[model samples]
Target: MRMRTKAVLLIVFLSCLAGCGSREPSAQSPQAASSSHADSGEIVLEADSLKLGQIRTAPVVVQAAPWDEFETPGRVELDPNRVSHVLMPVPGRIRQVLVRLGDAVQEGQPLLIIESPEVSAAVAAYRQAQAELRRAQSALSKAERDLSRIRDLFANRAAAQRDVWAAENEVAQAQAAVEQAKAEQEQARHRLELLGISPNEPVQQISVPAPTSGKVLEIAVAAGEFRTDTSTSLMTIADLSHVWITANVPENLIRLVQIGENVEVELAAYPGEVLRGTVRRIADTLDAETRTVKVQTELPNPSGRLRPGMFGRIRHSHGLKPVAAVPPAALVQDNEGAFVYLEKGRGRFQRRRVRAGQPRNGWAPITEGLSPGERVVVDGAILLSGK
Candidate 1:
């Protein structure tokens, strides 16, 4: 048994010795390889070089032809040409209101009937003047006949000279009376006309008619409201065929606006329907409070989709043309002025100062100090600045 145990122990010791030998080679080889790698200067330099600071690139392209640009923000207004107000020239109780707010009206169409004692009195005076004119005309005609007879008699020596002279005087007096009566009649007619009554010889009621074809925007007085004075505005009307878009353009941008320039308008109430217009008017003065110019663009309201007071936006373009520009993001505001990082060469760039014009197509026109076909650091410009 002791001999068997000794042989078995020797075999186990040899096996342990082989396993220790294998472990020594594995651990020693790895340490030697690590030390060798630590001594390699080329690899360290290559690793440092590989980290050559992150860089970004943006392609430079010439501004394409037919690039459109514009600005927005406006409000709808009444078209002055289509707007009218119906007012009572003579103060009286409104006998009836034939139209309501937003009612379409035609030229000379009766809008209301105002019952006024003053108007009636005017009519009566006009009729009395007409009667006087007729009576004076009759008297004048009779006097003329008498004058003819007297002239014949005097020629035949059958009438006295005093009688003929008296007849002539009477005829002359009648003629003067007719002239006075005609003048009075004309005065009465004018009075009636001023009161908005028809020039009919016998006027019954006054019809307040719309002076122009338009839509009534408001009716300040009701059926029984009294118009006390000329200051009272009984009704307001407007023409809806055309409308004005009042836009507040920034003062700095006012020069871009001009008469007859095309403007695109969009109303929130009518989404996606673009209304075309032209810059018809611009306020000579700027608003001190907002420091903006009031620009008015006239747009056709044919469908009547655009109503007064509807909020909208207006876009006025300076006219698109060929220009050298780049993405606005590339521009960096600096004390020296606007500038961009222009790529000088491979892995190199330099800051370039540039003058800019109004931004068009998301790019600003480089008025000076920049050219087309030059690569710029549009993105990652902030990162480059840190460097």
Candidate 2:
């Protein structure tokens, strides 16, 4: 029994040794270790491996193009120049509102009717002034006739010379009165014209016309509501044929934006639809509270798809600048973002994330991450990327 136990123990020991030998880690092999590290993105290669992979690196260069870029939040807004506010023309009850909110209107189109006493008063005053003018003219005619008869009598020696002089003075006084009456009549006529009423037809109602052609954006007063405040706006109308997309750019970044420059806008409501516009306006003063400058881009919106207060983003790029640039082979894109293999000396390559812009003319401007004069793996970068 003892001899059998010793032979069994030897067999067990040999079997344990064989299992340990089979479980040896692949790290023992240099090639296997390098392959494993290559899959991890960062590369550390030996002299032979570097030469075998045929890695070629090029120095980052300066490219004069749209090298600097940034995106900011934006919004759709109404153009202030095209916006019109309707105020109460006269103090009266609003008898009728001809248009509703969102309704299109034309210039000089009547928008409301008001039963105002001002119009009637103007017409009455005009008529009274006319009658007074007529009476003065009749009196002047009688005086002139008397003066002429007195002059003839004096010439024939049938009347005193003082009588002719006195008659002439009376005629002069009558003429002056007629002139004063004519001035009064003119004043009354002007008042009627201002009230938009005719002396021939006296009416208490006055129609208010639109000052400008546009779409009615708001209505503050309703029909039958008496308004005495003519200074307060009763409604708002704006020309929606063109709209302004505004974005508040930081005070530091305002230098990149200017009037008449083109910009690309994207709205959240319409994804994947890019709208292009020109910068038509920029605030002269900066906001003290927000420290931002309001910039507006005008876009032709004949279809009226863009509405005010719609949120979006504004992308602006300034003139060409000297920025770090690399070739397309140097850039590697994955789920995270675009990156490049930066070549450090001594067969060492480091992976770095880059803010690369659109590729242009075999060069991708690197807005961030890489710098000019730095070396990056351009050719055979795929070998270092390890898939």
Candidate 3:
């Protein structure tokens, strides 16, 4: 009887074990229930996992594209039209330098005085020309009187017709000599005028004057320096009231920037200062290696603050257009690049790579990938990113 009772108890225990195995297992805990499919760029979580992570989402917005902007490296340059190089007209020793480097001078102001033999030579030549002219005029007057006498003699049959012709030829030759003398005098006078000397007064000295109103940028001559090369530059001047800002823009973006468009310039030296400029010129050819086009902008520099070779950037707008944007928390940046978490609904999210703009007004403008009205994990994005 004891044996039969033990067998019945064992069967009952076996039946209970079979029932426990057949029933459904208990649900997994929150941490264990979460899954991340990195290969598919997706993440899924259970309701408990979502609640514990405190994930929150918001809809992406449509706004003006700060991404529709253009910027390129630029530099300040001197306008070629406003620059002047002073060259002496004749070989001379600099007697006195009236202006120093960096001195502002007006047009026609004397820059230096030169004691040149050329000036004295020009004066002597002019006096000689004057004497020649006077002698030629006296000869012409005598020839005219002789021609009149010969005509009267021919009319009275006292002189041959050939003699009258000879006298007329003499008068014509005298007139030609006078004309040549006058031309020589005029040329000499012009030469003296070019040397900045009055033709009426003979002088051994000449004053070189400024060609334009500008500041002296360079001076190659001193008070006692002798310069024999007349064609070489003795000094340099430039009008600093205006300047040019040149940029090398990518070829792909060349179409977007047109001549006559307005732009803003920011210099690396002056961090916060922004100056206005206008597009003035565009190069016809592209740089083969860089695939860039040269662009120039004219900028007013009345204050003379802009200097050549200063590093800067040229910025321009492409007009307002709709662009996707999100809060700062929604964007994630890593070694790969920038990305964001998009809500796929039902506690599911996906990673989307994007091109992002600099943050502004509490939002980051999306230049690529994301679209308007899409939902993104604005809060707890870091948690999803780790997964």
Candidate 4:
């Protein structure tokens, strides 16, 4: 009887322990259910929460607006027409590099000095030619005087006619020599001018001047380097005040891109900033490999912020088309895809999946899963997305 009574008390205590374990899970079931409900794409916020989150809503509408222009990956390039290639004018040893790479220079500014014996040789030839010309002029004057004196003697029977003829022939020969000498001098002077050296002061070192005002983009030689090729470029200068944004547009869309059409450019470096430009040129032929036409847009970069080789996008407006569009603030993204919150009623919003088209001018066109006349959370959609 005592063992039976102890076993019955033990069984009753075990049952009570099991009952408490089951009640603990039942007590926590409501919290799990509430969490699952919150994640069901439905968000209900009170007036205070809406104001705190600054959530604003607007009605979706179908409107005739410029279609969102598609973007093509492009790079910022220096305008080819504005670039100046500083080439070596003569084969010589580089005496001094007056300007370094990226130096700003004005027109006719001396960029570098080169030591060349050619300039000295050219100058010496010019001076020699000048001396020969002077001597020839003196000889011609003396010959003319002798000819006149001989002719006067012959008329007075003081000299033979042959002597007079000989004097005149001598005068003609001297005149021809003077003409030849003058031609040689002119040729020598022209050579000196072509070499960018003064005929009067032919120095061993020649200074290379900048042809245009621009920033130095490249340097191919250093001081003391011997450059033997005049055809090769020594440096490159480009005007960065304006730049070209070269974009490859598809052949189908090439018609939409005309010369002088205005465009908007966006660079990754400057987010949210739209740089305005105009189409300056369009390629006559399409690229065989890319099957696209190269479109060049010119933009004024007065601040020099736009740099060469910068990656950016070019946007141009097509004609107006009817589209279901919403403000950019209404769009939100998640692991699944982009979405927007639909207003079911006051303080009630449901997450709705959407396919968004290219955004333009602060508006995004909806391609799918949204209709006109529906209210969508614009400003505060991000807050609901977090919930």
Find the candidate with the highest TM-score and give its number.
3
Candidate 4 achieves a global lDDT of 0.87
lDDT of 3 by residue, 1-387 (tens): 999999999999999998877663543344334433545567877777745368889899987764347789999998888999999888888999999899999999999999988898898898899999999999999999999999999999999999999999999999999999999999988887788787677778889999999899999988888899988998999998999999999988888888999998999989878899999999999999999999999999998889999999998887766788899889888998898889988788898899888665678888899888999988888777666
Q: Write the per-residue lDDT of candidate 4 for residues 5-85, one digit (tens) a residue.
A: 999999999999999998999899999978977777567777666454577789998866666465787789999989998
Query: Would you estimate the TM-scores of all the predictions?
Result: 0.65, 0.63, 0.78, 0.68
Off by over 4 Å in 1: 1-58, 64-76, 79-82, 160-165, 186-206, 245-297, 306-321, 332-338, 345-351, 378-387
- Candidate 1: tens digits of C-alpha lDDT, residues 2-75: 99999999999999999999899888998997797565411211324432345455666567433344475888
**lDDT (CA) per prediction:** 0.79, 0.87, 0.88, 0.87
lDDT of 2 by residue, 148-237 (tens): 999899999999999998999999999999999999999999887766678899789988888898899999988999999989998898
Ten contiguous residues minimizing lDDT sum, candidate 1? 41-50
Ranking by lDDT: 3, 4, 2, 1
Please give the lDDT score for candidate 3: 0.88
lDDT score of residue 121 within candidate 2: 78
Instruction: Tell me how candidate 1 scores on lDDT.
Output: 0.79
